[model samples]
Target: MDGIVVFGAGGRAGRAVTAEALRRGYGVTAVVRDPERYAELAAEGVSVVRGDVTDAGSVREVAGGAVGAVHAVSPFSGPEQGFASLDPDFFVKAADALLAGLASAGVRRLIAVGLFADLLGANGRPVMDDPAAFPPEIRPFALAHTAGLRRLREAGEGAVDWLMLTPGGGLEPDAPRTGRHRFGGERVPEGAPGLSYAELAVAVLDEIGTPSRHRTRVSVFVPREARVRRT
Candidate 1:
């Protein structure tokens, strides 16, 4: 009851965050659409529950008595899953629900994972806008993610202290956790090598324990030299 509540706990990022939270000795409440699907996630200190990230009522119900919350939900998982069923306002709804629900539940911190495609490239344009940098077909998904980020900004110092950690490059699931990452501003860092989901989880948990950023989005990546030396 006194640990973090993680939405989309079945996803790779969500699972990594959950694992990291548990490793840090924090009890976890893993919220997923279908609790049965993630039964394996239920452990001695972890509880897998059914909840909706876009529904304020559901979020409030599941996130009650939590230290903080994580929004790791993704409507589009991969390129194989086309954008036909993707909702442009999915993240907007999520932002609204999370801000309201977390506030109502007395949880102050909200950390949302972000898409790398929306990060500005060296050309001063979104990576998604550059076909050479990102897949044009995935632009819609990036737009939705960016819209959610915009909603969070528009909230403007509301009850929930939120931070969006946008990956500068790729998120390698199979990579090792070096426990090292670099943070950047709006634009992607020069020669930014990506970090692992585990490393991302480290950043997420670090923020929850001792928040360094508030109501802003930052690019998180591993420097090319750091990646080479650490790996």
Candidate 2:
């Protein structure tokens, strides 16, 4: 209620965001498909609940009274997972649900994590358009993500204000938090380094607390200079 509700709390980014929120003393409503699976996420200031990101009723029910909400849901985790069951409209459905549900629940701020493949390359084409840059097999997921972004744009800045933070490079799951990141425009930052989940969480919470950007997607990554220098 007083804090933020994270939709995919069981996943890597969700867990990182939850931890970062807790570290910052913000109460968290960690939403997962199965609460029992994320029992470890429940703590003094954290509430683990079962919710579906694609279902407006579920989003409304779980997001009630929250200051902000996060959309970190991903239907496909990796190449090993395959795209056989991946829904092309997964993100579109999520965007619709979050917009309608959060508005109904009175939550005004929404932060949705984005896929990098949709970012433009130097050649003025989406990174996904170049097989050498992004795997062609993953194009469906990229297109789905782009469609969701489009849906959000079409909705405009009505009741719910949303921002999508796309990682410019890979996400190093085990990397440490440097508490530093940079925001870029439509094109991926030239030499931006990969961001750790912790760093990404920091950016997410920062925006929630201060909210510099609005109703637009931005690229987030560690500056090459911000990378930890090895001895």
Top model by TM-score, which number? 1
Q: Write the per-residue lDDT of candidate 1 for residues 8-41, one digit (tens) a residue.
A: 9999999999999999988899999888887678
Query: Please, what is the TM-score per model?
Result: 0.97, 0.96
Cα lDDT listed for each candidate: 0.91, 0.90
- Candidate 2 similarity to native, TM-score: 0.96
- Which residue ranges in model 2 land beyond 4 Å of their true spot? 43-45, 229-231
After superposition, candidate 1 runs with Cα above 4 Å error: 228-231
Candidate achieving the largest lDDT: 1
Q: Where does candidate 1 clash, by residue pair? A: none
